[model samples]
Target chain A: MSSPLAKPQIIAHIQKSLNYTVFDSKWIPCSAKFVCLGNFARGTGVMQIYEVQHGEAQLVKEVEKPKPIKCGTYGATSLQQRHIATGDFDGNLNIWNLESPEVAVYSAKAHKEIINCIDGVGGLGIGDGAPEIATGSRDGTVKIWDPRQRDTPVANMEPIEGETKRDCWTVAFGHAFNDQDRCVCAGYDNGDIKLFDLRNMSLRWETNIKNGVCCVEFDRKDINMNKLVATSLEGKFHVFDLRTQHSTKGFASVSEKAHKSTIWQVKHLPQNRDIFMTAGGAGNLHLWKYEYPAQRSKKDSDGVDVGVAGTVNLLQNVTLSTQPIASLDWSPDKQGLCVCSSFDQCVRVLIVTKLNVV
Target chain B: MTAEEFVSLQNQGAVIDYNGKVPVEHLDYGYIEKCKDVKYLEKILKVLRSGEEGIYPDLISFCETRLELLDPKNRLLITDKPVTTAASLSKDEWGQIVDDLKMWQEESKKTEDSLKHQPLLNDIIKENIPPIRGSNQSVDIQQKQNKNHCKRPLPRDYQEWDKFDVEKECEQIDSNSSTTSDTPAIVNTGLSKLRTTLDASFLAEREQLNLATREKDKGNEAFRAKDYEEAIAYYSRSISILPTIIAHNNRAQAEIKLKHWNNAMKDCQRVLKMEPGNIKALLRRATVYTNTGRFETAAEDLRTVLKQEPQNPAALKLLSETELKLQDEGMIKKKRKGKKILIEEVDGDDGHNEKRQGGLKGEIFWVLYIINHLSHNLYNT
Candidate 1:
C-alpha cells in the first residue's frame, strides 16, 4: 500500500481513550483539530477539541453542558468562524465557539425529543448557497437553520396532522449548484427517506428501504444532485443515482448487504466523492468506490427518461475495533486521514493508504 | 499511432483547479487580525507546521512564545525545557501520551510545593531529549521506531496515586459547596426536581436498575463473543451504575476465561458476600480457587455447592477433582479419589454446550442457563 502497487490498507494509527460515549466526531476544516461530542455517564454533554499533532490527538479544549449531545456538524460554518453546530438530547440546536463554549453562539429549541442527526452545507466555499444546517430529530421533524436568522429554523419538514410521526434518524444537504438550488435529504425510523428541495419547499423524492433508515448522505453537497447513499438498521445499504428521475420511478438504485449487522454510517471521501466508506455495527469499515453505469439515463417503456443505478465495488475492509463503530469523519485537509469513535469509548485515528490510486 | 494522437499540453485558465482550492476563510487579508478564534489558529499552525522557523523566521515564533506564556498547556511542552512546537508534527503523533505527561507535570508541581525534594530531576537532566524529529521519515518506519521506544515526559517526582472513590469525592464536593452556599436548602430540593426533568437519565431507581441490567446484557454479548477485556469493562460499568449479583457472577466467569485469577476471586467474593447460598458464585469461586492452587478452599466451595444441590453434576465433577488434589497434598480424605468418574453416571455432565447464532451476534448471558464448564474451549462467535 505504501508503494501504491498493493491494495489500500486501513491502518489504525492512533487511539485515544475517552471517558464518555462519543456519539459523533468531525474534523475541523483546513486544520488538524477535530471535535468529539458525547455524554458522560452522569448524562452531561461534553464537547472536546482534539488537535492531531505528530500522529497524536491532543485534547486542547473541553466543555460540558447539562444535556447529552447526539450529533454535530461543521458544514454550516466557514473555516474562519470554524463554529461547531450540535444537536443535544434535549432537542436543542446549538452552535458553539470552541474558544469559549460556556454559552452557544446560536441556540434554538429544534424539536420536542432528541435530535438524532445533523448536516451542514453552503459554508467553506464548497457549495454556492447560503450557509445552512439541517437537523433530523426523534420528534419526526427535519429542520434547516440559517445561522444568520437565530431562534427559529428557516425550514421545517414535519408529519401532517393526524399522521403518525416516524422518528427522523439522519439528514444531509445536496444539490447546491447555485445560490438558491440547495436540497435537504432526511431519513426516518419507519424506513422512509425523503429529499426536500429547499428552493421549492417541496419533497423532490422519497423512498422506503424496508428497515429503519440510519443514515443518508449525498456524495457531493456542492454540485447538482448526482448520487446518494442510504444505510439502514439492517445490513442493507442502497445507492441512488439522483441525476435522473423518471416520471414514475424516483431514482434508480442498487442495494447491497455490506455488513452482518446494522450499517451505522457511510462517509464519502472529501477529495474523491467516488470513493466512500461504510462503518458496520460489528466494528468493521468497508471502503467502496462507485462506478457510474455505462449510461446515466435511459428511456423507460413509456419513453420517459429514467436514471441508471451505479455499481459499488468493495475496495477494502478492515476490522479495527470490537464494538460497534458509532461514527467516523474524513479529514478535509488530508486524504485517507480519518477519525472513528466506537461504543468502547475510544476514538481511533485511521489512515487509509492508497485511496488516491484507487 | 501514438505520435498521430499526440497533442500539446495547454494550461486551461477556465478550469478551477480542485487540488489548489483554498478555503474561503483564507481569502480574507485581515483574517489573522480578525480571527480571535483559537481553534482556527490551531488549524493554521497545522497547515504551516513550522511557524517557529518560517520565511520571516522569528515573526511566527515570537507570537507563539507569547501565546504559550499566556497558557502553559497550550504550549505542549515535551519536558521541563520549553519547546515552541510539537516538532513539525508531520509524523506518527500520540495525543494521549502528551496529555498524560502534562497532567503528571502538574501533579509533580503540586507535590513539589508540598515537599521540597525532587526525585526524577537526575533522570530528566541525564536524558538527552529531542523535542522534535525530522518529518522526512515515512510514517510506518517512525511508528515501528516509536513502538521500540519513544519520547515520553517523566516528571521529577512521579509516583502511582492510590485508587480514588470518584463517586464519593463528587458527592463530598457537591455537599461541601452546597452547605457553605447561601442557598443550601434550595440545592437539596433542586436535585429531586432535576431528577424528574432529566429523563435522559433513568427516571427513578427502578429505571436505573433496568439500565444496569441492560449494560450487563451487553457485557454478556461481548463475553459470548470471547472479548474478555470488553466484557470486564462493561461489567465494571454496570457495577458502578448499580451492582447486581448476576452481573458480578458473570464478570467472574468472564474473568476466569482470561485467567485473571485475582480479579475473578474478588468478583466471586463480592457475590458470596451478598449471597452466601449463591450456587453459581460458589461454583465460580471454586473454579478460581482450583486454578490458583487453593485446593482446600476449592474443596470447601465445592462441598457447599454439593450440600445445596446433590444432583449438580458440574459441582460433583469439580468436587471429585478437588478431593483428588487434596488427597495428593495429604490434606483431606477422598473416598472417590481412585474411582474413574463415568460420564454416563452423571446427567448434564457433558457441560451445557449452547451455540447461539441469534440477532447480529446472539446469546448474551443467563445466570441459570449456561455455566462455566466450557472453560476448556469457549465457543468462538
Candidate 2:
C-alpha cells in the first residue's frame, strides 16, 4: 500500500516515576505546567505539579491529601486563578489554589457515594456564561454547581422514587458559549446517556447504548451543539450528531468498536475539533479523527428530517505500558502536547506532531 | 386546528365537552382575554408572512405584547421557528432539495456501517489513511541504512575501486604532466603543484601534529608572560586544529583568569563528557556552580570528588563552604517566616488595644530577640 498524505509522529518526551497509582492528570491552561493526582502506598492522595523544562518533567510542588483523588479539572476556573478542582473517593469536592497549597480554597460535601467523575465549563474566560461544575456520583445523581454558590447545587438530577439508581459514571458540560444555554451530558453504569438542558431545566434527550458508558464528551463547549462521543465498556463507542433533533428518534448516532477492551477515557484535542484520543483498559492509546458529512441532515422516509453522523478514522495506536491508562489530558496552549496517567504508577509526557496536516 | 377551536379547547381545560363545545358562561375570562390578544398577533403574522409593508404600528404592538407575555416565567419557552415567507419553491429547486436529502441519507448510512465488523476501518481504508509513526521510527532512517550498508562487504576488491581514488588520480595527472613538459616555466609550475600536493599529503597527519604542538608552546609562553587573552587565542587555535587535554585545560585556566565562568564551565563540561573522572574538570565545574549560586549542585559535585579522593583538601573545604551557604539560605527563609508570624501576633494584640504603645515595643523587641536566637542556633548547628 502507498503511504498516507500526512502521518502523525508520536514522541515520548519524558516518563516520570510517580511511585504511586496515578488516577488523573491535567494540564493548566495557558501554561506548560501539569498536575498529577495519585494514591500513594500508604493510602493517601498526592497532587504534584510539574513543569516541562528542557524536555524534563521537573517537580515544582507536591500536596498530600487525606483521601485518594479520583479525578481533577481546571476547566471550571480562570487561567489566572490556576485553581485545580478535584473529586476524591470520599465524595468530597475540593478546589485547591496552587499558589496556596496548604488548604483547599473551596470544599463541599458533594455526594453520598464516591464521586466517579467531574467536569467544568465556562471558565478560562472563553464564554459569557458563569463558570459551572458538574459532578457525577455513584449515588446515582448528576449535580451542576455554580462555583459562585457554596455548599449547594444549582441543578440536581436524581433517579425518581422507586426507580433503581445506577452509578452515574461521567458528566460533562457543553454548549455554554454566548448566552448561558448550557447542557450537561452524563453517562451511567446502566448504559443510559442523558443530556439535560441547563437553560430549560429539562431532559433534552436520553438513550441506552446497551453497555456501561465509561465516558462522554462534546467536541467543543462553545458551539450550540455539534457532536457528542460516548465510550462504553464493551469496547464500543458511539458518536451522536447533535445538530438535528427528531421528535421521536432523537439524535442520529453511529457506533464503532474500539480498544478491543473496555475504553476508559476519551479526550478531544483542544486545538482541533475533529481530533481526539482514547485510552483503553488494555494499556493502549489510539488517535482518531471524525470525518464530517457534506450535509448534516436528511429527510427520512416519513418526510421527517433526521441528523447525519460522521465516521471515525483511526490514525494511530500505541501501547505505552501493560496497565490501563486511567486518564489523559491534552494541553490547551500547545497543539499536540499531552500528559497521561496510567495504572503503571507513571506519568508520561507525549508530543504528537503533524496534527496541523489534518 | 383553527384559532377559534384552539381557543375553545384551551378554555375547556384542554378537554372537549360532550356536545363538542363549551357553554359560554363556563368560559374563563383570562382565556377569553388571551384569545382576543392573540388575534392581533395572528393578523400581524399573516401580514408578515405575506411579505407586505405598512401597518408598522400593528406589528410593533404585536411584538410588544408577545414580549410582555414571554418576559418572566415563559422566557426559556421561546423558540425560533422557521417562518415561511415565500409561497413555494420551483419544481427544479424542489427536485434539488430531494436529491440532496437522498444523497445525505446515503452518506450517513455508509459511515454508520464503516466499522460494522472491526474496531478500526478495514485494511484498504486504513492504508489510505496515514499511519502515525511511533517515537522508535522518528530517527533518521537513511543514516542508519547507510551505516548498515557500510558495515557490509563490498562486491569486489577494495583497491579495485579506482573511481574512489581521486587523490591518486590527481597525483597521476601531476606526474604525467611533469614527464611531458620540458620547458622550465612549465616544469617549475608543475613541480610547484607537485610540491604543494606532497606538502598537503604530508601535512595531513605529521606536520599538523607538529604545528598544533607549536601553538600549544606559544600558548604556554603567552600564559607565562601574563597575556591571558593572547594565551587563550593560541590555545583555541591549537584545539581547533587538534584538541588535547592540556590545551583545553590551559584555555579553561585562561577563561577563569578572565572571570568568564560560563565559558570555563562549558570547557570543563566538555572535558568531563570525554573523561568522567578528571579531577580538574570536576573541581572547575564545582567552583563555577558555587559562583553561580547553585550551592546544592556544587555540594553534590564536591561530594563526588571527595568520595574518590577522601583526603582532597580542596574538595573538603568547598563542600563545607557549600554547606554553610545552604544553611544560611535556610536561616533566612526561617527568619522571614518567624518575622511574619510575630507581626501577625502583634497586629492581633494591637487590634484589641490601639493605645498599647509599650506593648508594641515589647513585641518588637521579642521578635528581634527570637530571630537572633534562631540565627545563633542555626549557625551553631
**Residue-wise lDDT of candidate 2 within A139-197, one digit each (tens)?**
98887776666887777888766777899999988876344477889999989999887
Question: What lDDT would each prediction earn against the true structure?
Answer: 0.70, 0.70
Q: After superposition on all CA atoms, what RMSD does each candidate show versus the true structure?
A: 32.9, 38.3
What digit string (tens of lDDT, one per residue) describes model 1 on residues A309-345?
8788776777766788899999865567789999999
Clashes of 1: 8
> Could you tell me the TM-score of candidate 2?
0.49
lDDT of 2 at B142: 13
DockQ of each: 0.01, 0.01
| Each prediction's TM-score versus the true structure | 0.49, 0.49
Model 1 chain A poorest ten-residue lDDT run: A1-10
Clashing pairs in 2: none
What's the distance in Å from true for residue B149, model 2?
Answer: 81
State how far residue B34 of model 1 sits from its true place (Å): 73
